[model samples]
Target: MTSYAFTFPGQGSQAVGMGKDLAAAYPEARAVFQEVDEALGQRLSAIMFEGPEDILRLTENAQPALMAVSLAIVRVLEARGLRVSGHAAYVAGHSLGEYSALAAAGAFTIADTARLLKTRGQAMQKAVPVGHGAMAALLGLDLAVASEVADAASQGEVCAVANDNAPGQVVVSGTVAAVERAVELAKAKGAKRALLLPVSAPFHCALMQPAADAMAQALAEIEMRAPLLPLVANVLAAPVSDPAEIRRLLVEQVTGVVRWTESVRWLTGPGGVTNLAELGTGKVLTGLAKRIDPQAIATAVSTPADIDAFVAQLGL
Candidate 1:
C-alpha cells in the first residue's frame, strides 16, 4: 500500500478556465462550482470560467475560486472512489489552501468553506491600504539568512519573513520601503535574486493583524468539526486535529509565517508520507514537494484526464 498525503495549492495557482474541463466532464465537479456560487450569491463559476482577468484576480474572488476548484477536484476524486481519508495518511495545504484541505477532509461543509474564504479575502484586502505594504521573494537565501536580512532591513519598520517556501527560497512581507530595503540587503547578503512580488498586499505580517481579527470573529461563528485526517497546519508545521486548535491556528496564520518548507519536511519526515497528491488546479505544490524532498513522489490532479490517470493508478 502506498502512503500518500494530499496537498492543495494556494492563491497564485488560480487561472481562468481552471476547472471548466473538469466541470464539463463530471457532474460532481460541476456541483462544487454551483454550491460555491449559491453560497456566495454570485456567479463565481462564470468569473472563473470566463475571466475578466482584472476582476477574477481580485483577492476576494481568487481565494474562493481556488478553493472551489480544489474541492471540485476532490469531489470528482471521491466519486471515482478515491476518498482522501481512506487513502491518504495526511492532508495539508498552502495558506488559503488550508481551508480547501479542511473542506476536502470533511471538517467543514463546502458552502461554509466558500463563505469563509470570501470573508477572509475581503478582510485581508481591507487590512492594509494598497501601495503601503509589499512582499518580496529572496531567492538563494536560507530562512535564517532571510530573517537576518529582514531584521536588518526593518530599521524600526515592519519587515518580517512571510514564507519559507523551499530550500533557499524565502519571502518577506512588510511596509513597501522596508521590503525594498530587505530586497537590497538580501542581495548584498549574497542572495542570488531578491525581487518584489506582484502581490497586492503584504500578507502574513503585523500589517495583517486586522485581517486576523476579522478571521477570528468569522471563524468563531462557523461550526468546525475535527478533520477526518490530520492536517499539517502552516503555522505550526505539525499535524493538528482539534477543532478549536485548528480555529485558533487559522486566525494566527493570517499574520504568521507560512512554514511551507518545514510543513513539507514534517509530512515527509517522521510522518512517513512518501507520496504527495496535489488536488488543485495547478502543479505548484507538486513542484514544491519534489524540491522539498526528492525521495517523495508528487502528482497533480486537475483536469478530467488527470483525474482518470490518478484513479487508474490507485486501481479503483
Candidate 2:
C-alpha cells in the first residue's frame, strides 16, 4: 500500500476543457461540477468546459473552477474504490489549493469549498485597485535572501514575500512600486531572474488585508469541522488538524506567505508522506514535487485515463 499525500494546484493551472472529459466519462465527476454550479448559483460549468478564456481566467471564476476540477478528480478516484481516508496520510495544497485539500479531506463539502473560494477570489480582486499592486517572482534566490531583498526594496510601500514555492523560487507581492523595487534589488543581489508575474491582484501580502477581513467574516459564517486526516497548512507549512486553527490559518493565509517549499519538505521528511497525488488541471505541482523530493512518487490524475492507471496501480 502506498502512503501518499494528496495535493491540489493553486492558480495558473486552469485551462479550457480541463474537466470536461472526466464529466463526459463519469457521472461521479459530472455530479461534482453540477454541485459546484449549484453552489455558486451560476453556469460556471459552461465557463469551465467551454471558456472564453478571459472569463474563466478571472480570479473569481478561476478559483472555483480549479476546485471543481480537483474535486471531480477526487470523485473519480473514489468511484474507483481508491479511498483517500484509507491510503492517504496527509493532504496539502499550494495557495488556493488549500481549499481543495480541505474539501478532499472532508473538512467541508465540495459545494461549500466552491462558494468560499468564489468569495475569496472576488475579495482578493476587490481588495486592491488595479495597477496599484503587483507580484513578481525572484528566481535563484532562497527565502531568507528573498525576504531581505523585499524588505530592502519596500521603499515605504507594502512589499513582502508572497510565496516560497521552491528552494530557489520566491514570489513577492505588494504595491507595484515596491514589487518593482524588489525586482531590481533581487537582480542586483545575484538573482538569475526577477520577473514580474502577470497576476490580476497582489495576493498574499498585507495589501490583501481587506481580503483577509472579508474572509474572516465569511469563514466565521461557514461550518468547519476537524479533518479526518492532517492538512499541511500554507502559512505554517506544518500539519494541523484542529478546526479552529484551520479557520484562523485560512484567514491568515489571505495575507501570509505560502511556505510551499517548506510544506513539501515537511511532507517528505518529518510528515512521512511517500507518494503525492496531484488532483487538478495541470501537472505543475507534480513537477514541483519531483524537484522538491525525488524519492516521493508524484502522480497527476486529471483525465479519466490517468485515474484508470492509478486504480490499476492500486489494484483496486
Candidate 3:
C-alpha cells in the first residue's frame, strides 16, 4: 500500500483572500476562522480576507493567518470524510508551517497553535532591528557550497545558511553586511544567481537567538502531546515522536537552518512516504517536492474545488 505525506507551507505562501471560498461554502470551515479570530482576540480573518497587503505581510500577522487558512482547508477535507490521520503516514511543514502540521496531527489544538504562532511572530519580528539584518538566496549553489560561502563571508558577524530549499537553492541570513558579503562571494564562486531577498527579517539564523529564547519560554507553558503521526522536524530533517523533543526542536528551528532538502530525502527515501498532499494555502511546497523528487505525486489543496477533486480522486 502506498503511504501519504501531508506537507504545509509557511510564511511566504500567505496571500489576501485565502480560505474565503471554503468559509463561505462550509460551515465547518467557517468555524475554523471564527475560532482563530476568537483565540487571537481580534479580527484576523478580516485581515486575511481583505488584507491591506502590508498588514497581512507583517510577520506577526502572516504566521497565524497562514495557519488559520491551512486549518480551515483541513476542516473542509475532514467534513467530507477524508481524515488526515487515516491518509497520512507523516506530516511536515516548512518553517512556521510546522505548527500547522502539529495541529493537523492532533498534537495541539488549533487554538493553542494560533496563540503560539502569534507570540512567535511578534518575538521573531522584534529579534533584530529592522535594518540591521538581511537574507539572500544563493541560487545554483548546493548546500555545501552555500555553507562555505556564508562562512567565508562572516567576519565575526552572524552569516549562516537559513533555508536549504532544494538541490541548487539555498537561502542565507545574517547581519546586513554579512549577507551582502555572502551574496558577492556566492556570485564570485560560480553561483548562477545570487540575489537579496525582500524578506523583512533575517530568519532561521543566529541573529534569531533572542526569538529562540522567547519561544523556549512560550513553548514551556503550552501543553504538547505526542503527535498522532510522526513529524519530520525542520532543523533535523528526521521524524520525531517525543513531545519534549518537538518543543526543543521548535525553539532551535528559530536559529537553525531549515534542512528542507534533507527532510524531503528522508521522507521519500528512508521514511517510505509517497503521495504528498500539500494541505495549505499555496502550491509552493508541492512545486518544491516535485523538484526534489520527480516521481512523487504531490497535490495542493486550497479551495472547495481542490477539495472536491482530491476526494473524488481518492474515491472517498
Candidate 4:
C-alpha cells in the first residue's frame, strides 16, 4: 500500500533559467509559461529565462516564477502520460508554493494562481519596511528549543518561529534587531549554526498580519474548488480538503509557522505516503525530505530526464 505525494518548492528555489529546458522540450511546458505571462500581463518568461538575478530574485517575481516552473513540470508530466490524480495521494508546498500545489490539484487555474502569487508577494513585501524586519535560520535546534530562543530574544519585540523545516532546522522571523538577537541566543543555546538570512522582508510572522488581511480580500474574490487530493496544510500539518477551509488556512499561513517537519512526518507516518515527488526547478524539497526522513523515498522531477526516470520506475 505504498503511496506518493507531490510537493512544490517556494521562493528561494527559483533561478534565472529554471524551466527553459523543459519548455524547449515540451509544448505543454511552454504553454504554462505562456499562460503565466498572459495572466500577469508581462513577459515574466523572459525574466525567468534570461534574468539579471537581482530582478528575478525580487519577491513579487520569484513567487509566481517558481509556481510557473512547478506547474510547467506538472504539465509536462501530464503530457508524458503521468497524471497526478493517479499517482499522488496528497500535495504540499512551502510558503507561496502552496498556491502551486493547489493549482496542480485542480483547485485553481494557472492564470489565477499566477495573479494571486504576484499579489501575495507584493503584499508581503509591503507589510514591513525594508531593513526594519528580518529572518534567520537556526540549525541543530528543534521547534521547542527554537521557540524558546525566539521567545527569550523577543524582549517586547516580535521574534517568532517561521518555519519548522526538519529535525533540527528552524527559521525565525521578526523585527531586525529581535531576529539578530535570536541568532546570538540560538548559538549560545548550543545550536550548530545560526545565521541571518538575506531576505527582503520578514515573512510568516505577526509582522505579516497586514499581508494576511490583504490575502483574505484577494482570496475571497477567487473561485476555489476542492482539491483532487488532500493538502498537508503548513499551519495544521494535516490533511485538509475543504475549499472554504483551504481559503481560511491560506490566509492563516501568511502569518503562521510552516510546520514542514510535522507535515513530512505525517505524510511518511500515518498517511502512508512512501514517495515524495518534488516538481519544480530545484531539488531543495527533495533534500529536505531526506533530512526529515531518510527512509522516505524522495525524487525530483524538473527535467525531462527526471520525468522519464520517474515514469519508468512507476511503470506509468
Write down the TM-score for model 4. Answer: 0.99
28-132 in candidate 3: lDDT tens per residue?
Answer: 888999999999998999998998889999998999998998888888888888788788889999999999999999999999999999999999999999999
> How many Å off is the CA of 52 in candidate 1?
0.8
- Model 4 has how many clashing residue pairs? 0
Clashes of each: 0, 0, 0, 0
Least lDDT summed over 10 consecutive residues: which range in candidate 2?
78-87
Between prediction 1 and prediction 3, the one with superior lDDT is 1
Please write out the lDDT profile of model 2 over residues 1-316, one tens digit for every residue.
4578999999999888878999899999899999999999999999999998999999999999999999999888888787777878999999899999999999999988999999999999999998999999999998899999999989888999999988788999999999999999999999999999989999999999999999999899999889879999999999999999999999999999999988999999998888898988999889888888888899998888888888887788
- lDDT of candidate 2 vs native? 0.92
Per-residue CA lDDT of candidate 4, range 196-272, in tens? 99899999999999999999999999999999999999999999999999999999999999999999999999889
Task: Compute each candidate's TM-score over C-alphas.
Answer: 0.99, 0.98, 0.98, 0.99
Cα displacement (angstroms), candidate 4, residue 34, comes to 0.3
| CA RMSD of all predictions | 0.7, 1.0, 0.9, 0.7
lDDT measured at residue 263 in model 1 versus the true structure, 0 to 100: 95
Show model 3 residue runs off by greater than 4 Å.
Answer: none
Candidate with more favorable, higher lDDT: 2 or 4: 4
Q: Model 1 Cα displacement at 122 (Å)? A: 0.5
Error of 4 at 44 (Å): 0.6
